[model samples]
Target: MNMEDLTWGQFKALLLAHPNLHLQFKYAEDALVDASYHITEIKKAPITSVDCGGVINNWTEIIIQLWEPQGKMGGDAMKVEKALSIINLVEKALTLDAEANVKIEFGNSTFYTRQMYPSAIAVHGNDLIVDLRPDVTRCKAINRGGSCVTADKGEECCTPVKPKVQLIDLAQTNCCEPGSGCC
Candidate 1:
């Protein structure tokens, strides 16, 4: 199933009902985090930025941070019910936006720390597989409009224009040279 199709709240509700399911995160084809990882923190990140075209953009995300404890080995993964309990605890302390997008934050000595979005979810035997994809940068202005800068492709928008340079002959000018009286 496409995990992106569901909001954070809907996903949490699904998990809460599936008490026996196990979770495994696949960051890449070869990069997988098994049950040894712990849900260290649940955060609400609100981001606001001005795009290259000077338009302001704002959004929020439910950030889930996973940590693999040192010297930990393959073990029974955290159950879905246990994760729901953690979420409940977080909700008690801080309000979470149910409709906000969900992002998983993880990294290791070999992998740089980064936030990834859930791309897909699948059930493999007894495990719930979550495939995470890296977020990409896009030109917000272009996405919101046909032109790069503005919607109307008017004077404020970016348009291709031929470059021109005017050449001036210093000798033909009235301005004086070092010895000229016009100096």
Candidate 2:
């Protein structure tokens, strides 16, 4: 998740407030998860990475995977109350970080399998829609005012410069003169 993304606490709070509403997930414009989608699993992952500036960064993410079984068709989405129950069940097994970023894992025949952040949660009629946005690639070093390369901002973060080499004219050397014995 990005710096401005919704956190796990925020997501749960929204669900709590709309317990009576049906939960619907929108991955893209006009692209929504099937009404029969299931909350297959919830994963808590801790990520540690070294950025280009050699800075160690750590974060946690709470990912909820949604799956719709094949041949399953038209039905109303699960109620927010049921989704909360699943969350509660997962909490019994592992402690979830409220501050962790939230992601939704889902895919169908048209959408690719990837984790998306909850950009917005809105009430549309009887449905509580979780609008998901794809996770984007970013340079942590650049975000922290450091450059990945010297050319980026005239500040070298990790890349090193290659030393310039000059060529020598071997034809001008005296080694072929036979030690000055005159070949």
Candidate 3:
């Protein structure tokens, strides 16, 4: 609800404080971005239905559309799954929001976690209440101690770059249950 720097710990606190909040997402990319992903060509996304889904009373759905993939991107096959995974990951942030020690720095501009709800969902037009909020996190390389530890309290394995994300979380966050941070 607040737009300011937040440590992972602070973010955890907020989500833990209010675990019932839901999340939604919308992705708008230019024709160029789409074309690049497919490695082919997309004249334009006349009315692109990017990805959609989230907790509707508890279940979340996710879908993605790209121009096309010519070769076998075995990883590409999991595109939809990845989207959902992102949702799940973020929900962890929320459920563990109370336990997160958030810290972020974007090139010279030091910052903290901030909760951002899409403007599209802000409208109380329909009889719909916003169920999710997109959260912002500082990428690992850009922030302090943003490295990935595949196993906690154990030896560090692969350290990956922090994701520059535009992620959404549902109240139950689809992948997370009440009081469970999707861990």
Candidate 4:
């Protein structure tokens, strides 16, 4: 499929409406399994101070704050180095195992995050936790690290990853939102 043909809005909208649009993740060892989560939220922090929330580099995995920010479930409260470390894990794994996939679970058995972000994970001071949601099942297509099973059920393979985690890589962080002037 020609990704260039699809706009982010179209792509995301498709995802939101898709019956199989699900998320997946990996761990220390073992094939990538679906991650379980209680809540999810998106916040913006300088790439240098971002511990969770929002996708860092466009190609890396997405992050959700797992700690409460001043008693709020969703607010600015994370560290950048920590965020990069998590991104590094995903990059490292994708490089070594291009076939990796991730799964995410949400609270209340909803495939999507609750309208009210749950503060459970964040209250513990843990980084954003990765997991699968109950409402949606899985994304329909997977060209990169998606689910343990490829998007098309044994059709597409993962994309190649560039070398990462080197010190120079961290210094080269760029804005991720294309054309939005953020990156």
Using lDDT, give the best candidate's number: 2
lDDT against the true structure, each candidate: 0.79, 0.86, 0.30, 0.30
Cα-based lDDT at residue 54, candidate 3:
14
* Cα lDDT tens digits for candidate 3, 1-183: 342334334433343443333321222221111112321111111222321111122211221222333342332122323334443565555343322222211111121223332223232222112222344543332232454333334433334337686555656476555665554
lDDT of 2 by residue, 14-116 (tens): 8999999999999889988989999999999999999766679999999999997787686789999999999999999999999998999999887889998
Which stretches of model 3 miss by more than 4 angstroms? Answer: 25-183
Model 1 residue 154 distance off true place after TM-score fit, in angstroms:
3.0
Model 2 vs. true fold: TM: 0.83
Alpha carbon RMSD to native, model 4? 22.5
Candidate 1 residue lDDT tens string, 1-183:
456545788778667666798888888787787569999999998889987676899988899999977766887788877888899999999999888889899987777889998888777788777788888877777877566755444544445555786665668875665754454
What ranges in model 2 sit over 4 Å off? 1-4, 146-154, 158-183
Question: Taking the tens digit of each residue's C-alpha lDDT, what string does model 4 give over 1-183?
Answer: 332233323323333343232332222133122333222332222222211221122222223333222333432323334334454554555442221222222222212232121111111232332222223332333323444344334522334345564343434555464664443
Candidate 3 least-lDDT 10 residues: 103-112
Candidates, ranked, TM-score: 2, 1, 4, 3
Which candidate leads the pack in TM-score? Answer: 2
Candidates 1 and 4 compared by TM-score, better number = 1
Please give the TM-score that candidate 4 achieves against the real structure. 0.20
